[model samples]
Target: MRVTRSLTIKQMAMVSTVTLIIVSLFILLQLFHFVQQRRLDYAQQMESVALTIRQPLSEAVLKADIPLVERLLATLKLSGVIARADIVLPDNIHALHNEFILEKPVPALVSHLFELPVSIRIPLYSPERAMRGPLALLVLQADSARIYQFIRVTVATMLIAYLLLALMLTVAISWCINRLVIRPVRHLALALKTLAPEDLIAHQLPLLVGHRDDELGQLIMAYNHNQQTLGSIYNEMYCKASGFALPSLPNEALFLALIEQHSKSVENAAPLAVIVLRVETLQETHTLVTDDQRNILLITLVNRIRDCIDASCVLAQINHSDFALLITRDSHIFRTMRLARKMTRKLTQPVTLGQFQLHPETSMGISLHEKETPHAKELLNRASSAMMSAHYHGKNQINVFRTGNGDG
Candidate 1:
């Protein structure tokens, strides 16, 4: 819920910013065109009014009818379009103006911004049928006070309208994004709180509702897949790390699986052998050596057994004093005997036992996975039995399990 709130706020901010920008641009453009067109219409209307009265006004001025001239100008002013009307004599003295001011005057800024052409000027003609140039200059200026009022109102209206529009759009879009996108992600985050590696086999992560065919759905699927793979991944790492005697090998749990897989393969079914080596002198040297020396001797024995074989075999540490290896390639009783002797010879070498050099006595055992020894467990049992047999025979020895071996 908190994440949903945070995401909504961020999305709202972005939407509001974009809406404000677009609305501002649109308002400015419309206002610009409206002002230009209104001013043009105002100028045209004023000029037409002046043109309609041109003839009679000129005749009255020629006749020296000052009252008539005043009446014409007053009528023109009362039309409410012309702001001022003036008549310039030859010496340029007499001019008339509409001194009428409105109760609600346009603001000064609006007055300045919408200032029309100073005044439209027209020349008077003579009384002859043909035009003669001589009378007075007629001047008229348009009163845009109403147009200015409309402009002000239009600007304010647009501001209010766009502000409401932007607010509504921001709210709607933020809610949708939070519901569709953020909510699912929030669900995923909550689900991940209880998810772990060891719990994969026991628990299943809950999937998102109403989003089974989208990206979030794919993400949930991938998450469940990750949980599944983690079980095997952690298992593999544990197998590698579980080898205490030799750090690079697996313990019995993984080694048993390895042996089973090897025996199941058709190419590797040519009767493999499980060879185990036991440190016979370990119990006898228990009190004679410290824990550090005993561990060093065991580690050294495992390393020597590794040095005796190559990559064709699978080596693993079964327990404290027992190490197992699988002879997968070129495995027969004769070659197994030779490999066993080699392991026995290598493991019985002198080791540094804290200022004392002592030879570790080791016994090697071998059991082949034939018709009678089919299962991996049975093979390991016979190999262990042979190891016990060699342990009782001599200091360093090699023994192979026969058909009736390990029964005692």
Candidate 2:
């Protein structure tokens, strides 16, 4: 069985949030336990101090020894556990060693919730009787300020720790997700959206997506494979239908597509020119040379044209003996004419093929784009017509198509 490995941003958030909550709850539980334990310990300490002074306190009260009783109360008050201390007589009389009194009555709810000061009343009995009736009352108020301060500090510390932990977790989780998951996914999505047939043939994918080994990588590989397969099939169909083998340069379909796309862009305001070059002596050269020799000659001719034109110019073998050059708006009429003449001179030069010197006659025709009629097919047709007219003039001739020119 395969276990699916999938993690999303939402899932990450939920997991992190749950983890933080659990940790916070655990800290709170520990804090509560600590507070309760401290409270019990403090209460025990207060009781122990009261017990230690019980005998003296009893003797002083029984003999009506005010000085002795006052000293005992003062000693009891000195203990950190006791916030206040006093002695009370049976006749409803009271003597406070420190004159300690409750400054303000605390609400029951507040006291219960926060565990405020607690008052303990211990009965004093006669020393001889051991269990006789109480001679005096010893009241001790537990010092709650220290415990309350501890509780407040502990709660604040825990809250701050929880927040810091949560922040750190969030940052770490988000960074991991973005690096390992979200970023890759987003990159893949954009790559898919912008994936082109040419890019697939070149085996190009987004940087991160191409390098990954996960599901996104698999998806991109699959897409690239499909695109390559489709491109092969399309090329096969194209060659069969056109009755010509595919050439190294862009096909007529791609050429026309580029022209149409460029025509739509308003930013291309310069004049555009389409130049067609027809090899008039191609058949003669083919009969005189082997297939290999013919290929070399064609390669040499294409290379010369490429050297003469700017890299941005689009060149394509449009037909068996014809080539098309697409000069963008960046070029002017003068530049286009110069390139056409240069191509004519290059192609008409004598080439040595297997001990035989052969010179191929070529005709060049150029047509400038007209704003009123801006179509690729129309421009190509006009250039073709001009090339045919050039063929009528002489070998290695050039012609330019103009509006209302019967020659075109």
Candidate 3:
């Protein structure tokens, strides 16, 4: 058996994938925002520390206060903004916190998303020294090792939360769809399968319980109405019609019902092939062979013809020696013509009827369906006319009728 995919699985995958993409975009945006905010806060703190120490360091340097310069540099490092500082005023001095600890570092790709400033430089001057440009430059490099460690801890925790949220959302969405939609549709299908086609009035589909006044509930009501209509219409046609009662779609008696149904279709599938196939030899067998033998042969031939079609089509015994095949699901009539040839081959096979051994002769007529003749009755008449024309031409003949042509 071929495995058909369930609606739930499809819905789950589609909904989950879309949601994950959205969540990922949001997380990416949030990461950029977090980094931007951290950069702003770091800039403010570093500037404040640099300003407070700039004057004292300048004064210390002007008075040649070596001890004061050391104290100022130490304070700048301890203030916790700059990772490493460098003072350049002819004698370049550097101070770095070698004890800075980072618990976890963010990946290079994550850190590169935003172009955050790595370091800043501040110029130091003293008016008291009567120096116009006699000053030092204070360079501060950011403590990214610590900043990224903070980001990593936050992101790791949020990633787990996001994963859990996505899983829960997928489950919730799939469950809701199955309960609200798929389950109801499945129930409707099961109900339809149990319905008896011949006696549709007695097998009314029960309305969906929770979906009253909704679209699905309305659909169920319409289905029950259709069943009643079909049953009553079939009963009426069987009682009143004078001609041969068409067998069901599965049997010829229901052929009129299918015609009635298809007549109402605007497209009714495609430009169909309405065919009238006459087994001239099968009809001749009625006179030469026993009724039982003829019936057996007819049944066998019908089954073979049924095998040629895979999709839904109407096949019915329209006459004692004739059958009608309506290919309503085809894209073109070429496949129907191929099927006709195959059926012709089946008919030509020799049959042993007691003492008589004979090969059946067949005459087939095909009419192309068009928007001008949407009714199955009209299409059939055209094909039947064509079949009669084929019969006039002699045995084993085929004739095709164009939609608008008067002379087929």
Candidate 4:
């Protein structure tokens, strides 16, 4: 799996949310279990205390002695289990009551005391009153310390667990996603970077993720399909738009596209090579040669030059005497000047079309395509400027485009 250099913010957020949810659920479960265990313990303790008070509470009710009942309630409270105790009479009278039974045994309580869920226990007593009277209702309450302790410990454990889980999840998800999504994308980006605008061929992207019925997979597939389609369209357009029979050189559209492609390629990438050639001393040769002879000479010269062009080369006539050549990066750009020299030398040889010596002089200029200006016209201008510079400097010379080397 590939890894991306960086994760998009949205992907990071999604991973974070998933991790947070898992951690939150774990914490919630822990807290709930603690609360449940705490409640069970408190219930057991309350039941025992209620049962313990049964006999004494019944005896106190039979005698209706408020003082004894108070003493018993105080002693029970001193045990520190119950928070509040109340013993009522058979007449439903508010009798002996010990309300201090509800306060905490410990002096320090957590500030969020009210946050703890409280449980209440009400005790019903049947006082024997000639076997005819209804029993009194007794009520008891106490701090849920056992339950609270469980909750406290549970919350602490859960908080720690949540923190640890969150950390683990963050690291895991970032790595997983980086491998799954980012890595593949980075690989694709590198491939795209390799693509030159001149590269009409389509490239296949790598499978970053194992094929899954997931959204990311679908997106990758769609993008790859689109690239193929676009590549096809580009090839068709270029084929129909850049080449034709050598004589006419097709229409302006074809020529312009050739220029644009070279220009765009230069802008997107490193410098390319350009050559400008103008027929010098053509008029002098044509003075003795007829119009038909001149036409044939120009046509023959263009054909000869075109023969030397490579696959990714463009040759176009800007005017009757000037032509432009665009080529991919060549190790020997100066070789083009040599080639032009050879062609001019061969063409300048005296031709006898019934006693006519047609000697043509050609001037050549070359320049590197760079990002500053990649337009075909701009490159052509530079080449033309260089050629003019060579022409004015000395006849029949080769020139290379350079900064401040304007045509004199």
User: lDDT per residue, candidate 1, 219-336, as tens digits?
Assistant: 7787778767876677666656665533466788777888888888844367898988887667678888888777777777777887988898998888777789998988888988
* Clash totals in order: 0, 0, 10, 9
**Judged by lDDT against the true structure, how good is candidate 1?**
0.77
lDDT, ranked from best to worst: 1, 2, 3, 4
Candidate 1 matches the true fold with a TM-score of 0.53
Off by over 4 Å in 4: 1-10, 29-33, 78-80, 90-93, 99-134, 144-150, 200-203, 206-225, 242-408
- Comparison by TM-score, 3 against 4, better one: 4
Off-target runs (Cα >4 Å) in candidate 2 are: 1-247, 266-268
* CA error at residue 1 for candidate 4, angstroms: 25
The C-alpha lDDT values of all candidates are 0.77, 0.76, 0.73, 0.66
TM-score of 4: 0.51
The digit string of per-residue lDDT tens for model 3 on 1-408 reads: 232987778889898998799778777778768878888888788888888888777787677677777677777767675776666674565432232233244577656765533577787777575777757777766677667765777688768888789889989988998999989987877766766765556567777789888999888888878878888787667644533432223334456567657656736567767788998877776787776877767776777778776666778777778888877676276877787888888777887767778788888998877777556677778888888898889887888877557535
Which of the two, 3 or 4, has more lDDT?
3
lDDT of 4 by residue, 156-239 (tens): 877887888787878787888887777777677787787786663576665555754566677667878888999878766765
TM-score of candidate 3 relative to the true fold? 0.50
lDDT of candidate 4 vs native? Answer: 0.66
For residue 159, model 4's alpha carbon misses the true position, in angstroms, by 0.4
Higher-scoring candidate on lDDT, 2 or 4: 2
